[model samples]
Each structure stands twice: as structure tokens, then as C-alpha cells.
Target: MTGKERLIELLKLLYAVTDEDHQLSTAEIVTHFAGQGVPTDRSTVKADIDVLNNCGIEILATKGTQIRYYFSDRQFELAELKLLVDAVESSKFITAKKSDVLVKKLMTLAGENSAKELERHLYTAGRIKPENESIFYAVDIIHRAINSERQIAFVYFEYATTKSFVPKHDGEPYIFSPYAMLYNEDKYYVLGYSEQHEKIVTFRVDRMKAPDILDKCIVPRPENFDPVNYTVNIFSMYDGEPYNVTLLCKNELMNYVIDRFGDDVRTEITDEEHFTATVEVSVSQTFFAWVFQFAGGIQITGPAIVKEQFRKMLEEAHN
Candidate 1:
């Protein structure tokens, strides 16, 4: 083989056998190069490693009874790759088949030996996976739209009487400004400015079909529009107008309150055993149901209209 060809084979050899966890000895690398029709000795291999390092490859050598070498810096460390694998396996937006494909691709970021260790930690069993496999493609298109400040068009689907999804609004196409992608409650949602409603809205990205970026410009997002606040106000992804509501809760439920509302929740101690918290929430049946789940341990205190609304909902349910 030509000298250039021999150098190329040596470089490939370093990548193949050397990684963060496993470093090949000089003799082992020589054996690999010999099988590739490019004979290399320890001295030539050492020179090749210098050439690679000069080229910014960062091949590191460790001294032992016998010196061994490995690539010191990789695009992703093994722990980072494992975190990515876990995200892929646990993502509800990705289908089971696609999750396997993604995990396999992520495993390539680690060395062969480290990949085996990563595989052992991946546990996707019993997780709910999306049936729609084209969600990833849709997400890519949406991201492009967002980057270019352009609108996107897609057909929205709704469940039909036949236990299947049918095009909604009589197959009418939806053109919206892609604002942000959100992963909440193990599901993926795209929050955007809907042209149909002329307001910011959220849609489950998995239910979108035939998504394409449009040449049209996107409507600019509103001033001081907080996506985090919008998500916190809504319950179970249900849509509603946000209301500043107050609730009196037992002191024992402090953890649940803080967990849901975070540390920013406004609280006032009410006589030792109870406290009152005022939070902005979407006043809906879903919010009432969540309160009801507390079994009288919580009570809506203010916004007479909301309290009346909750009372009527309970009265109607009792009937």
C-alpha cells in the first residue's frame, strides 16, 4: 500500500479500537494495521498518533507496564450518550420502532464496549409510545419554519366514530406560525399563533399530517407573552382563559402545592393548620376535578365567579 493509504488505515485503526473506556496497546494496533495490508510498528504508530494529534484528533497515551492509547475527547462522552439514549427511550412522541432506531444511532456516539454498557441501562418496556412515526419529520419542518420566521401548513386530525382519525374541519388545512415546541406530561405539543383563531394555541404535534413550511411570514409573537406561564395555567393540556384564583389548603398538602406551582407560589399562613395560596390558573372543569381529587383538603377562596362556577359544576355532577 502507498504511504498515504497506510496513514489513512492507521487513523481508522485508532478510531476503531481506541475510545474513552478502552485503549489499545501498541502491539494490538500493529496487529490491526497488519491485517489491513499496512504493516506498522510501535515507532511508526507513535509517529502516526502525533500526526493525528497535530491534525487536532486529540489521541491520548497512558503509561503502564505497556503504554496504551485512546481518543481523549469525543463529541459526546459516554454519560452524555447514555442520557440521550434514555431520553429517546422515554419519549412518548417517538414510536417504539423509531425509539429503537434512535437508541442504536445514539449508541454509535459511544465506543463499542461503552455502548454495551449503555444498552444494559436502556429500559423502554411498558412505556406508552406514539403510533405516528412521522412526528420527527413534522418537528424538523416546524423547526425550520420557526428559524425562518415562516408559517407552516398541515392537516389536523380528530378521532372519528369509527375508532380512527379523520381530518378535522372538513379536511381544511391549518396554516400557523410555529412558535415553540414543548414536552409536557410525556407528550409533545407545538405552541403557535393560529391564523384560524388569531391567537396563541397549542396542538399535539403527533396528530399533525403533511406538514410543510410555507413561503408566508409568521405573525409575530405578542409582547411579554410567557410560554411557561401559559402552560402552568392550563390543566391536562385543556384550553381555557387564565384566571387569578385563590385557594385555601391544609398545611399537610404544602409539598403538592409547591410541586405544582413551584416556589413562586404566594402563600399566607392561615391559623397554623391551613394556608392560602393565590395562583393564576385556567379555571376549567379539569382544574375543578384536580381540586376535587384533594377530597376537601383544599378550597377555592376567591374570585366569586370561579367559586360559583366550581360549585355549579359540582351541583350538576351530583344531579
Candidate 2:
């Protein structure tokens, strides 16, 4: 092999063979080069390593009598890789097949010896993954439309009794201008302007089909629209009319309140045991269910109609 090609291959070999637990001396590196069919001497290998270090490959070396060398300062440390792998495995939007594919790809970022360290973190079993496999591709198409500041068209789907994806609204595609893709509750959702709805809406990416970027320009976003505030309105991804509701919350459950409503929730101390919070939320069955989990620790204290609706929901559940 040529000199430059041998230098490049040496880096690859270092990645394949050297990490903290497994390191190589200059003599050992020369042996590795010979094994790869690129004959080189110990002096040349040492010079190549110096060149690599000058270029900032982060291949570190020990200063002991043996003076072993190893690749360090990777793009992703093992902990970060473990976190990413856990996210992929637990994500409900990514299909099991794609999750496996993504995990495998993430592992490649780690070195040869360190890659095996990540193997024990692979646990994709028993999680409820989406059946749709085209979500990743769908995201790509949506991102293209968003990047070009144009519109996109896609068929939306719903599950039937037989667990098959049947297109919503007679298989007609929805034309939309995607504003942002959101990752919430381990699922992916697209927030955008819907042509048919005449307003911004959110749709699950997995529930979409035939995502294609359109040639037309997107409708300019409304000046007053804030996606961050709008996201709070879609509690649990269920859309409803936004309302500023008051809640009577227990003192100890304040963390849960902030956790759900963000840190900016308006609050007034009600008494020694409870506090009153005025927060805007999209009222839906899902929102009511969330409040129901807190038992009497939380209660709707205002807008008699909303309180009545909660009462009706409780009654309906009771019956």
C-alpha cells in the first residue's frame, strides 16, 4: 500500500483494535499493519501516530515503560451512547425493526472494544412499538418540506378492528405546512397548518402515509401563534378547546403540577394544606383522566361548566 493510504488505514485499525481496555505498543501496531497486508516498520508506525495526533484524532497514549497507545475522546462516550440506545429502545414511535436498525447504527460510533460494552444495554423487548415502519422516511419528507418553506401532502391513517392501517377520510391526502416535529410521551408528532382544518394542527407521524413535499409555498405562520404554548394545549396529544382552568392542588403535589404544566404555572397559596393554580389546558377526556389520577389532591375549582363536565366524566366512569 502507498504511504498516505497506509496512514489512513492505521487510523481505522486503531479504532478496530484499541480502546482503554485494549491498547497497542508501536511494535504491535507494526504487526497489525502487516496483518492488514500493508507492510510497515515500527518507526513508520510511530511517525504515523504522531501525524494522527497532530491532526487531533484524540488517540491517546500511556507514558509507562511499555508506552501503549489507544483511541480515546470518542465522538460519543459510552454513557451518552447508552442513553441514546435506551431512548431508541423505549421510543413508541420507532417500529421494532427500525429501532433495532438505529441501535446497530449507534453502536458503530463506539470503538471495537467499547462497542461490546453497549451490548448489555440493548433491551427492546415488550415495549409497545408502532407497527408502521415508514416513520423515519416520513420524517425526512416532512423535514424537506419544512426546510424548503413549502407545503406537504400525506394520507393520514387510523387502525381498524383487525389491526390494519385504514386511511382516514376515504384515503384522501391532507395538505399541510409542517411547523415542527415534536417528541412527547415517546411518540413523534407533527405540528403544522392544515389546509382542510383552516388552522394549525398536530398529527402523529406514524399515522401518516405517502408523505410528499409540495411545490407550493407554506402559508405564513400567524404572528401571534406560539408553538410552545400551543403544545401545552394538546395534553397527551389529544386536541381540545384551550381553557384557562383553576385547580386546587395539595401542597405536596406541587412538583406534579409543575411537571405537567411547566414552571410558569400561576399559583396562589390557598391554605395550609392546598394551593390554587390557574393554568391553561386543552380540556379533553385525557386531561380529565390525568387529573383523576391525583384523586382529591387536585380539583377543578372554577368554570362551573368544566367542573360539571368532570363530574359527568366521573359519573360515567362510575356507572
Cα error of candidate 1 at position 281, Å:
1.2
Report the C-alpha displacement of residue 256, candidate 1, in angstroms: 2.5
What residue runs in model 1 are displaced by over 4 Å at the alpha carbon? 1-5, 121-126, 234-237
Worst 10 residues of 2 by lDDT: 229-238
lDDT of candidate 2 over 1-319, digit per residue (tens): 8888998988987887788888999878888777888778867878888999999887888877777888885788889999998888887777888888888888888876777777754556667877777887888888888889989898999999999879987999999989877777766788889988998889988888888988999988899877777786564427877778999999999999998888888999999999999988888898899899997899999788889999999999999
Question: All candidates: CA RMSD in angstroms?
Answer: 2.2, 2.3
lDDT tens per residue, model 1, 1-319: 8767777877676666578568899998888878877766999988888888999889999998998998766788777887888888887778888988888887776766677867844566677777778988888888888889999989999898898999986898898998888777776788889988887888888889988898999998899977777777664426766788899999999998888777889999998799999988877887889788999999998899989999999999999
Using all chains and alpha carbons, the TM-scores for the candidates as numbered come to 0.91, 0.91
